[model samples]
Target: MASVEKVGNIEPMPKIYPIGGGKGGVGKSFVAASLGALLARHGRTVALIDLDLGASNLHTFLGMPAPKDGLNRFLNKHAQTLDSTAAPTPVTNLFLISSSTCSMEIANLFYAQKIKLINAIKKLPFDYVLIDLGAGTNFNTLDFFLTSNKGVFVCTPEPTSIENTFRFIKAVYLRKIKQLIKRHDFDAQAKAAVLDTASNALTSRDIMDIVATYDPEKERFFKACIGRFQFKLILNQFRKNADAGLGKKIETVCNRHFYSPFEFLGGVAFDERVIDSIYAKKLYVKNYPATASTMELEQIAELLANGQPASSLLQPAL
Candidate 1:
């Protein structure tokens, strides 16, 4: 990947993982922070970016009493480059680019600002860059989530969380479709047919059928674009073996319902110490090494570090 200095000038994009769940209190910032600590422990240089906008608190999770500088500096032109805004954390080889200064208005970035931020993030000089996205499927949240080399979705067993998780995935997929077709014209009839949100043209199959009806050749290529959307899922707040199976169930539903690759990378059991660590101002992975959640997160981090495929996530770990 390119150094943060040369991001906009033909530098390679870093391996970025944007973590988000559709709802708040779903453990996205926690997962992002813990994963960043674990990756640093594994000897990889990692950056945890808080893109939660107005509700940003990832710095607190990382034990940052006060992040004096961050993304806002770059956005406001106080910092010339994105790298300069990254603040050091207690963990070695791990840094943080917080959104603590962002307000509700900052969440809605201008198109030019969005492009600049994305370019800088893509070229950060780190082995891994994990973005903690905000709750709900807003355009900013979805756009950041889509910027990842591998998007990571965090959800608990709660029915609402599960449903929203699916909604978030579908939103991202459909957004990609819209992005692809926005630049290239299909047929006027096909455009009007699918773009009509009131209709039942919701599924990938439905859209493909509409496109195929208009032009068979374009349908094949558009289907390929849809097939490229891939992401990893982590089930959090798991309390029992039944809850463990929720990950598998969600994966199955997504595989059957969506066109892209979705994998469940094991679940983090509910551990009281996680909260205790949070209150103690220490990273859970750093303070509670023996906790079940910490161990499971380490396994997930190992798999991610090793470049394990989505198919491999089906197997149990650690």
Candidate 2:
């Protein structure tokens, strides 16, 4: 667990990545744990926050009993800071702040409480912080996901999961546009791109067209906000020949439909050992080093930790 420290001595803000699924039982937690374990194994200080909130169960992936102290303490005033509640996990250099112990009402966080937690999350001292979010495209989930330096969407190859994940991505994009519009002093053209309800989001003119609609000087300004988002995708439980190629397919769909800077990071293959590791209450990457899943997870973590430029990650000609 990371001990509380004063802000003056801390380094740069750590890379924050929030992982969420369109629905449950798609192995979002499994993929999250594997990434955390891999990052920790590589000697990065990692914090895995189980923001599945009141129903938190990420501790199970780390092979631990339910956390007795965490977000609840900070929220209920038992602790002064959220970072102080990070509980040490079995993995070296990795800590978890599970909130399964929180009361049911904690799931419905007030705006003030959510802001407080978000501010605290940014201040936590670590190389990487991966938030495991609850299922849904609700305000809480999208807010947390957007707070990440890079938003990660995890979904199975199933059509339902893929469609819902698309919905979640679109929801987050709308939220992102709203935030950028509020924060930046956008001119009329830029404002219309975001505020216009009739704009075809997936077809016709996308964000680039909106930026070009502005005056030449203002075009750069609008592009800086509309064209600069980094979101990563992971396809899990991949089982067939087509499944292996779904990464590029998703990238194409995102480009054509949402004008999104979504990068298909990689895919995780279906493996029996994953279930075995889960049943044994251990992270598959840490416990089954020789497995194909572990190898794929290691590669994905490496790519994520390397942190490519948003434009480079996205498909060309977008």
Candidate 3:
């Protein structure tokens, strides 16, 4: 295990990447671990943070023994920094920051605690800090997800997962707009004035238009905000080619509704090896690299790292 100092001069303020899925049982942590391992294998120092808080299982997925310390300790100032809780995993260049052993209560975190945790994550020394966000659209999860430079949303082909994923995406955008509005002290009076001028309800597009019209100077800032809000969608547990199309469908819906172009990350097929690897408490990539599921995950890592379009790799070859 290499010490954090051994990472050599920290590669230019690594990009913050957050992995989140609206609903549970969507394989968010599994994909996060695989992506981190792949990045580390390519010589990038990666910090995999299990932000799942209450139900954190990233340590088990990475094959690391349960930690004696974690985020909870740091949040309480019992630990000095996030690095203190960082544990070395079996994968080279990959480290795990386990979640606190505390109960899985989302409301357990106060506003100050939330800000402190986010600040600590921003200070971690790594080339890529991948946060495995807990399931749901609660303020805590949404705030952390938005704080990252890139946000990846994972979903299965099932309708329930897709519906919840849409809700999550919409909630994030709406929250962002509200934050921006509050920053300018756009109180009830100002909001009423803006609403009277617009025909539609308070949507992201309407917010942008209002900002551009009245707050012209901040238009560029809002545009940059929308541009920086990158999203990548993945369809997991796919059983057939038809199932893969679900990703594109979701992407279209997101683009139409949110006015955001969501990248379609590749899908993972239903593989029994994944289940077996989990049962054995091992990473699927290291345990069964040759399996179809593992290969698909590798492709996802490659696409994300290179910023390649999902359709180019996911489409059937003519």
| The best candidate in terms of TM-score | 1
lDDT tens digits, residues 1-318, model 1? 222122233435567899988988989999999999998987999999988888888877887675877898899998998988989999999999988876568877887787789878887889999999999988778778877537999998888998898888878876666665555678888887778878854865567777889867787778776676568899888887545467888898888877778888879898888788788888888888867788788778877888663343345455
lDDT of 2: 0.77
lDDT tens readout by residue for model 2, 152-198: 88998899998889778767766665565555567776676656778
Candidate 3: tens digits of C-alpha lDDT, residues 12-90: 3666789887999988998899889988887988999888877888977887777776777787788898877788889
Output the TM-score of candidate 1: 0.88
| Superior by TM-score: candidate 2 or candidate 3 | 3
Question: What would the TM-scores of all predictions be?
Answer: 0.88, 0.82, 0.83
- Clashing residue pairs in candidate 2 (N, C-alpha, C atoms within 3 angstroms): 202-257
Q: Model 3, which residues run further than 4 Å from truth?
A: 1-12, 103-107, 185-188, 191-224, 309-318
Backbone clashes in model 3, listed as residue pairs = 54-104
Clash-forming residue pairs, model 1: none
Number of backbone-clashing residue pairs for each candidate, in the order shown: 0, 1, 1
